[model samples]
Target: MEKVNLVFGTVYGSAQFVAETLTSKIAELDFETNLIQSSDLTGFVPKEDELLIIVTSTTGQGDLPDDIAPWFAEMKSAAPYLPGLRYSIIGLGDSSYETFCGAAKQFDELFAELGAKPLTARLDIDACETMEPETDAVQWISTWHSAAQSLNQ
Candidate 1:
């Protein structure tokens, strides 16, 4: 079975809720899914066959959540090459903020810089537009799953 690493960072837990909601959906698609907190990962590198899904919510002044900042910084400092990795990002933020989904954008850029290929376009869920980000995120998983399966075929 293919594997999905669902890594998430949350401030008040919205992102974590979204990630947890997707886990069952991912399993329904027959992919083995692992739900991980961003802070829990250390010196992590993606395997070629693994799919990485990053779900993050921006915090104060468009910064990564406290739990994820150190991990992201470490990854940046390591700057490992990731040409074989395929991934996607789900960003949750308010459009009214100057840096809406800024953390996710930063992650996307960093992944691109490290040569990680995106499985699909990033999904940005605006707090101003929706009360339930998990709903939007859940809808996106099917599309992302299709893209992941396509690569294997």
Candidate 2:
């Protein structure tokens, strides 16, 4: 019965949609889900019973979305000290861009640096792909959920 936190760092709102879907799916699996933007992460840390899921998109020239800038910096510096922060990530970007899914990659690296264990591999989606966003998210979540079930043990 642990809480699941779905954090979004979105630019064009695509990432937000993915976060919402993730929240709903987690709820269906019987876990409490808190949907928040990455900006809200500053100074607020979840407890050990919480699971964090990040959905982020790379903005212009591979920058994080406006809201996540501050949190990103703090997390980068503080990650190594974080306690019991198990997490997963889904990054959206256009592979055609020079920095494909840069934001997602950054967060993944930060979480790893901070000692957070990933429930699943970071799922990276290319914007130019023919697959719909929802489909990609659903696929990733299905795999993630299976992996996450073992996390609370």
Candidate 3:
């Protein structure tokens, strides 16, 4: 089975919680999984054939979190060719913010610019709606995985 790499960028830690839940769920699906903060991008890179899942939150009026901004900045500056990457995103933000899920949206665009393909539509969860993050992700992840698996064949 291909490994699943889960990355998160969070200000108040909600994204991390979501990532953990996703990691557990993905493992239950029998995929080897690793959950890490966006800052840990240096630790590993998802191969062209692996699945990448990103969970990020907009911080301080649509900015990346402190721990992740630097890493994302590096990625933007470096802009490594990643035409082979297949990924999905779950962006967490307050709908009240003008830039709801801004960070995640930014990354989604950046990934495309870097030549990565989005395996599915990015899931935008509005915290302002009192949505349950874990529950939403659990359901979405299952559906996303099913879609990815089918496409893989």
Candidate 4:
């Protein structure tokens, strides 16, 4: 009965917005879900049967938001083996930054090293672009839904 959980890390709040929208949309699509922020996680780990979707916004210099940095550092150091975890990430950032989406890239890599399986490719949504910020995320979720529905997470 493990549900899909949406974990977001935001500085200026764009990632939170995206996470909220995704939570609503995913619920509409009939999946049980939970939305959690970085500060909300303290000794949190997904059950072996759970799925996770991470949406994070890079802060200064493509750094992980201060709230989430410690968690990532801990995870990296601990290297928790989540062999049954399935996840995907949507990264928000401005393309102008030299390290655009660096945090997300790091997280994605780190998760793999921890033995989590990716449901789809990591998506980078550039706030600098003219398109709506959530457009790509929405589309990616739709595409992923069909594919993921057929598989066990």
State which candidate has the highest lDDT. Answer: 1
* Model 3 score (lDDT): 0.85
Per residue, candidate 3 scores C-alpha lDDT tens digits across 1-153 of 778888888888888999999999889888889887665676354678788898988988788887778777877888888998989999998888898998999999999998999988999998877567878888898678887788659
Candidate 1 accuracy as lDDT:
0.90
Q: Write the per-residue lDDT of candidate 1 for residues 44-104, one digit (tens) a residue.
A: 6667679999999999888999877887898899998889999999999999999999999
Stretches of candidate 3 exceeding 4 Å from the true structure: none
Q: Given candidate 1, what's the lDDT at residue 54? A: 93
> Where in model 2 is the C-alpha error above 4 Å?
none
Distance from true position, residue 118, model 3, in Å?
0.5
Pairwise lDDT winner, candidates 1 and 2: 1
Instruction: For candidate 4, give the lDDT of residue 81.
Output: 96
lDDT score, candidate 2, position 36: 82
* Clashes by residue pair, model 3: none
Q: lDDT for model 4, on a 0 to 1 scale?
A: 0.83
lDDT against the true structure, each candidate: 0.90, 0.82, 0.85, 0.83
lDDT tens readout by residue for model 4, 26-65: 8888788899877778777766677798899898887898
- lDDT per residue for candidate 2 within 8-106, as digits (tens), equals 888778889989988898798898899986656887664556888888989988888987778888766665465577788889999999999999998
